[model samples]
Target: MSDLPVVVAARRTPIGTRSRAFAQVRAEQLAGPVLRATLADAGSATGRPLDVADVVLGNCMGPGGNPARVAALAAGLGVGVPGVTVDRQCGSGLAAVLDAVTAIRAGDDRPRLAGGVESASTAPTRSVDGVPYDRAPFAPAGWPDPDMVEAAEDLARADAITRERQDAHAARSHARARAARDAGRFDAEIVPVGGVLADDSVGRAEPLLPRLRPLFPGGTLTAGTATRISDGAAAVAVVPHRLRGGAAGLVVRGHAVVGCDPALPGIGAAPAVLAALDAAEVRTGDVAAVEIVEAFAAQSLAVLGRLGLADDDPRVCADGGALALGHPWGASGAVAMVRLFSRLVRAGAPAGTLGVAAASVGGGMGVAAVVEVVR
Candidate 1:
């Protein structure tokens, strides 16, 4: 417990719209540069050469062949540095960070880089024997296995989340994101990608959000309220607490991954957050900030309402979320952590300030982690 890990540096590529600037860029292409840039940032910020022992990344759709290892070499991390990848759908990136934290807690003191990348523009069309398919089922036989959009609708129905509420939340997301971008809050951590310096998806969607129709019949969610498919990559440098040195940092306190009803996957993040906070011996009120992936405005609202939090909870996504920034599938989870890093660590929040990063998976699972600002 005393040897918990801490993030020394974090960086991510500017998220690109689907089939736009990053259409030709592969997942490895987005990941490799961010990996190299994170290491460089750590070294330059800490004023010391940090040796990375492993590179662990999360990927949902990349040509199947250990993309982490490929990205490691591409980033010039060397053939000696070990690499591994995890797949948990949308939660993959945060899960990767949890795995690294676990490894370090078990006594591996070497520095490691963990995050995720997604290039939806470049993801290959999956097929079975030449028949095109959208996605594989999340549940087994006799289990409810609805596609993501359907699951979100189910969750909205179950939680009584209204279209008006969803639109309001999404509009708020965009407004906050645009304000943050305008203030240059994102510039410090966003690495240039495909010649773009800022996230291209963020805008003032409030005025137009309420006019958008539902994505599915009888559903409350709309394209304006749901996250956009995007291309981006994010990585963070983690080391043993004793070795941590940087601007200001976050210490890994606790983490949990829990399962829920696959038919209503959007609600998974709440249970995961409860489990993680319990594991860390902290209460919701204790956390100074929160980052729950906004897969859909309905899903996010469901989580907040179930947790007894308001949609406008100041602690959650104070600078906006996936609804505004766009969701790069695997990369969105790490992007949440990067947001928390920017607010609590880089911005120099008071000592002992607690923050959480959490996301729901496609397979009815949720990954949540707790961190403390080391002021």
Candidate 2:
């Protein structure tokens, strides 16, 4: 029996713009349905009832008292399964999945559920010393800590990414997402929530993109070129490869997490991807699919350039990304992995087809995983 972890099922809630369809939903509420659906899918694939050993979830700005435990209980997983929450900012979801992979590699063969959830609409306001603050500092004092928007603007200037290019990229993302949705390409992986069956943020933005003003003075980034604040959840079921029962799935190969200069946080994914590919003994040209979180068009373009990919590479985000689907912070990374699964395993890609999922985190860090289709 192969000891490697294999993802047999993946699902996500329809992403909603902040203060919109999911405004009344809590973090655990958003996560519960997807967890239940993922477990059922995994059970159907393996043709046996799974004794889930644990539940691992990631979150950013939700009311915290171990949300993962609450979600597991809410999903009716029984009281026997223990749960743990992970926080790596934007990389939380993928990191949680990697944690499960680590456990399976350590000889614990029990099935595990791992993913991330975020409720931007219902996130509690925080205070420090009686003064309210929007978010905690990403870096400690004496470090270059810039707001994400500001960092994107700085990266645009440094990389000489033109305004026209950013606008075009964002427009392309929206068009692709719209086309995919229309063709029902997203139906298989989405679990309807809050009466929303489809992502609300994908729209025709080309006309409005060029009309928007720069977010910062003398900067190229505009609201149209940046991902919207959103609420959503995504989860996947992982089990030992021996239990796959000849079913199609993603076999976990290698993963890496690395940090870069805080000032150029948007470029962090480049090194992490390189390291992950090296660990898997795969080359850049050999990957059949890639999904990198699209927090900002300029930031994504910069990372792709560093990785020696063209600005409009078809292999990357073939059906669009966060810029069109919306960014739910911690859940975005897991969403990327789910996208890779749908594009490869669900689409009938042959065995041994390689794919990559990655995200450039807010605090100068990157997380990436290499997976291959197997039967």
Candidate 3:
């Protein structure tokens, strides 16, 4: 591991529509290619897994217990390389990345494989998933009751997330995202996978903005404003180095994971970020950018208000966020990280680039991560 963990490379796949049944195969099938490409894009061996530390990953859906382990082995990672799979619901991807950073910064391990892979194609929608509040006998013990959207509505009512404010936020997302898509800001980060219906690579590289219709007439959040359920996976490789001359190396500095009540889902990330920022001793102002997953238009607005981030700030996902792009659950974290790293490189500002990615699961289960891009 470098004296400090620098993000040598980052890559993400386009958000996918699983139920749309676009003839796309399984989740792992998609994750494999992106995994290889991420390594290659970094000038590292994409196919040849590194010999450094461990493999860490997170996923929301089941069917693949220890997904990180399975993904690592399936994608040709080193044999016997310890693999860990964590479930932080929406924050699964960030959680996985953080786990690797924590291990390295704590000196428990160095040069580890840290990233997240999520495929909505593998799991059922929250409606059919029997997620506690949706039904009884919650087979998935960790799956809390009450859907994330319901929780967001509740929060908005209590916190005064005005419909107008939410609508304005959603509109800005579409406008800004469309602009970013036009400008090619996401070029360096997005990985073009095989199965794509859109002629352009990044899904929204070609605008479908004309079709911004909502099922409800006066809906506060329109289809243009919310994150779409998508299918895809993303991964990044991290290595350690011993910088000579007492220099702080360009490596991932560290990461943190915090626990909070699952009932309030969207706002759950506040505690996690506080703990992470404390461990890194970094402040929000010092952060160059944040990639908070936009689960819903209202959800994102609520989280931003709580975090005190300016909605129009250039530092937060300079390239359109999940609302404009899409939120593919497991795939979204990698997507945010990939874009954040690219922006950091272009800005050349922070020695330690910080990225914040948040997600909301049913109940109050929210996950957050703070990653530093060194080099």
Give me the displacement of residue 281 in model 2, in angstroms: 0.5
Q: Compose the digit string of candidate 1's lDDT tens values, residues 280-321.
A: 999999999999999999999988887789889988999989
Error of 3 at 271 (Å): 3.1
| RMSD (CA, Å), each prediction | 1.3, 1.0, 4.7
For candidate 2, lDDT tens digit of each residue in 1-375? 277889999999999999998999999899999999999999998898889999999899989999899999999999998899999988899999999988988999889999999999999999998999989998999999899999999999999999999998999899888888998989999999868899988984557998999988888999999999999999999998777776678987889999998888898888999999999999999999999999999999999999999988999999999999999997999999899989998999998999999989887999999999987
What TM-score against the true fold does each predicted structure earn?
Answer: 0.97, 0.99, 0.80
How many backbone collisions does model 3 have? Answer: 20
What residue runs in model 3 are displaced by over 4 Å at the alpha carbon?
Answer: 21-23, 42-49, 78-82, 108-110, 124-144, 195-224, 243-254, 350-354
lDDT per residue as tens, model 3, 1-375? 345444456666665565553234455565656666655644442233345467776666744667777766666755876677776666777667766665666676455655666666556344445543322221257655555555666666667776667666655666666677677765655666665522122334225434555435544444544566667666766554441122222344434555555556677666666666776678888777777777776777777777787656766655656666666666566566666666665446456556666565544555555666444
Q: Which model, 2 or 3, shows the larger lDDT?
A: 2
Clashes of each: 0, 0, 20
TM-score ranking, high to low: 2, 1, 3
Most TM-score-accurate candidate: 2
